[model samples]
Target: MHSERASLGLQIAAIGGLLFLHLPILLIFLYAFTVEERTYQFPPPGLTTEWFAVAWNRADIWPPLYLSLKVAAVSTVLALVLGTLVAGAMARSRFFGREQISLLIILPIALPGVITGMSLRSAFAIMEIPFSVWTIILGHATFCIVIVYNNAVARMRRLSGGLMEASADLGANAFQTFRYVLLPNLGSALLAGCMLAFALSFDEVIVTTFTAGQQSTLPIWMLNELVRPRQRPVTNVVAIVVFAVTFVPILLAYYLTRGGSETAGGGK
Candidate 1:
C-alpha cells in the first residue's frame, strides 16, 4: 500500500535494526576463530580452527556445560508439565479473580530480572535452603514456565470447547478425551513451548547468579572467563556453542508455531 520510496526506507530501517542487534554476536563468531590468545585485535591478526579443539579439550569447561544441560532439561520438563496444567485451567475456566491469578502466573517473567533474582535469593535464604543445582533449576523454571504457559494458553483458548463436549457425548471419560482429543490438538503448541523454555533456561544468567551457590552453569562460566585471563578464544568458542544451543531451539519453536492458527492468523 505504501509508495516504493517509503517501502525501501522501511526495509533499510529494518536491516539497520537487525545489524545493530546482531553485529556483536557476529563479532563473537569472528573472534572465536582468531589466533590471538589474550587481547582482542582489530580485524583479527589471524584465523584458525584451533579454538574449537581447545574448547573441546578444556577440562574446566565440561562440568559447567554438563550442569547447564542437566538444569535446562529438568527446568524445561517442569515448565511443560506445570505450565500446561495452568494454561488448561486458565483457558477453560471462568471464576472470580481469574485475572489476578493470571497476572500472578506471569509476574515472575514480567518483573525485571534483578527483582526476580533478588526475591528468589531472599526466599532461599529465609527457607534455609542451601544453593545447589536444584536451586538453579527452580530459579530457571520460574521464568521458563511463564514462556510455556503463554504459548499453551494462547493455543488452548483457540480450541473449540465443543470438541470436548462432543468427546464427552461420545462416552469418553476426561482422561480419554484429553488423550485422544486435547493432546493431539495441543501437541505442536506444547512442543514449541517446551523448545522455547529449554532455550531460555539454558542461557539464563541473572537468576542463576542468585541460585547457583558455588556452582557454575555455562553462562556463569562464560562470565567468569571474561573476568579472568585464560585462552580468550576458547571462551569465544564456548559462546558460539551457547549461541547455537539457544538459537536452534528458538528457531525450531518459531517454525512449529508459525502455523499455530487453526485458521490463518487465528491465534496471532
Candidate 2:
C-alpha cells in the first residue's frame, strides 16, 4: 500500500511538472485562434482560425521569416564543415593544450547569450565589419559549431581508430577512408546536429539582435510586435509557427540519436 501511494505521488508530480512547463505554450495555441485581438481575455472571449490567415497575409512577417531561414541554412552548412573538422582533429590526435582548445570551442555555447552578443558586437566594431546578414550568420555559427562538435566528437571518440589504420593499409587515401568509412558512421549524428543547429539559429534573438543591425529575423520581429502589436492574434499565430519549426527538428534529432551514442547535444 505504501509503495502504491509513493508511485501515485510520483505520477502526480510528473504530470504537474509537465503542465507547469507546457501550459503557457498551450495558451499560445489557444490565443492564436482567439477572435478578440486587443488583449488576452480569459477563455479568449471566442476562438476562430481567422488569425492564421492574417499572419499569412502580413507582408512584414515574410522578410524576417526568409532572413531567418537564409541565416540558418548558411550557418548550418558552415558549422557542418568546421565543426566536423574540429571534432576530427580533437578526437583523433593528441596535441598540446588539446583539452583547453576543446573547452574554448564549446565555450560560446556555455556563455550567456548577452556576453557572446556583446563580444561579437565589439569585435565587429574593432574590425569595422558591417553589421549585416553575414554578421548574424557568424554570430549564429559560434554556437552552431559547438552543437555539431559535441555530437560529432562524441560519436568520433567512440569510433574505432583501427578502422582508419586498416583502410590505409588497404591503400585507401585519407579522403577515401573518411568518405567510405567515417562518413557512413557519422551521418546520423551529423544530421541530428545540423537539424538542432538550424532549429536554434531560426529561433535565436539576442546574438541576432546585436549582429542584425538593420535586419530583423522572425524572432526579432516577434519581439518587436509584442512591444507594439498590430494584431495580437497574428503574433500568437507566428509563435505557433516558430514552435512548430523548432519542435519538429528537436524531436527528430532526439529520435535519430536515441538509438546511438549520447550525441544529441543539449544546452550546456
lDDT of 2 by residue, 123-201 (tens): 9999999888899999999889988888888889888989889999999999999999999989989999999999989
Candidate 1 lDDT over 1-268, as tens digits, reads 8555557889999999999998888999999999988899888989899989888998999999999999999999999999999998899889999999888887887888889889989999999999888999988888888788888888889889999999999999999999999999888888888888888889999889988999999999999988895999999999999999989987777887786552211221
In terms of TM-score, the best-performing candidate is 2
How well does each candidate superpose onto the true structure, as a TM-score?
A: 0.93, 0.94
Predictions in order: lDDT: 0.87, 0.90
| Backbone clashes in model 1, listed as residue pairs | none
Candidate 2 lDDT for residue 143: 87
Compute the lDDT for candidate 1.
0.87
Q: Model 1 RMSD to the real structure?
A: 2.7
